[model samples]
Target: MIKTIIFDFGNVFINLDINGALQHVRDTFKIDTLSDEMTAFNSLYEQGLISTDEFLEFYTENFPKLSKEELVDVWSFMLKDFPEHRLRFLKQLKSTSKYKLILLSNTNELHITWIKKHIPFYSDFKNCFDAFYLSHEINLVKPNPNIYKFVLNQNTLTANECLFIDDNADNIDTAKSLGIKTWRIDIESEDVTNLFNVKTNLF
Candidate 1:
């Protein structure tokens, strides 16, 4: 019956250029790709295994040439802008009271802090969700079965009764494996502006 709608926050709400961040760092720092250590540390960073200060320190110490601000800039480059129309759509959906709306995002503390600072209506958008789960805060990131299981357990939602929407195909596949219905949306084609079409009874 789809009693709940679990949404991925990145492309679903705010625009994120995942490639942009990598490119930004590569070009600016003269680096070809992420280092093996950085790649390994990222998993821990995303899961909140390390504190924010520890993350910033790791980069700052390794790249002495790059200033703290510049490191933050490259790290934060994936974030672009949040459109106004999407916020309105969420507001409309919240008013409907048809389904339990939850946001599950694989994001870190620094990016989240940046979002709140940049987006004027950040609080309003968050208010629309029945639950807003962040990977760093929850110590669980998506594409892992445990994170999906955590949400299901926390909300007491059965897999069959929830629909998961994510821009990442891997994340969608993981959700589907757990018996949840999923929409692996293309960020370009899927305008969440027409969310009502995807959902029924959201009056």
Candidate 2:
């Protein structure tokens, strides 16, 4: 039986336009793709290896034309409106108290700060999760085996008894490799509110 439900914060919940954001950056910055150094800084920021000021400095130093505000807006372009229905569903689920709820997200301080400022119900959404693990705060990003291991170890959870839901195939694959049940959510057609119906076999 699945005793715990782990969720990804991006498309699985708040909705992220990853492709759109990338395209926007490429067009605006006149770059076809991110350089190795830029990619490295992004990854480092996500894992909290570097502070927010340092991350901002790296971008500003490289892109002198962009201001700090502009850069932040660009970085947050992927984030869109969070549906209240999802929160209602989560609240209902939490009320049940049947399964342990967890949120595992690969995100940085800047994105989180932006979320907190925009999403009014951010605190309520967080309260639904029994345990909240942010990649930046924990210094462990997803798709990495060690991060999954850390969650399992921290909660003393049995791999088979946990269900991890994410929109990323790589993340889902990694979780499955560790013997954890997973749902690779389709952000477009599927709604997380239909979790019980869609994943009926698991329930």
lDDT of 2 at 144: 98
Mark the regions of model 2 whose C-alpha exceeds 4 Å error after superposition: none
- Highest TM-score against the true fold, candidate: 2
Clashing pairs in 1: none
lDDT of model 1 at residue 184?
77
lDDT of 2: 0.94
For residues 68-158, what per-residue lDDT tens digits would candidate 2 score against the true structure?
8999999999999899999999999999999999999998999999999999999999999999999999999989999999999999999
RMSD versus native structure for model 1: 2.0
Give per-model TM-scores: 0.95, 0.98
Q: Rate the local accuracy (lDDT) of all candidates.
A: 0.89, 0.94
Give per-residue CA lDDT, model 1, range 50-119, as digits (tens): 9878888898898888888888888899999999999998899789898899999999988999999999
lDDT of 1 at 48: 94
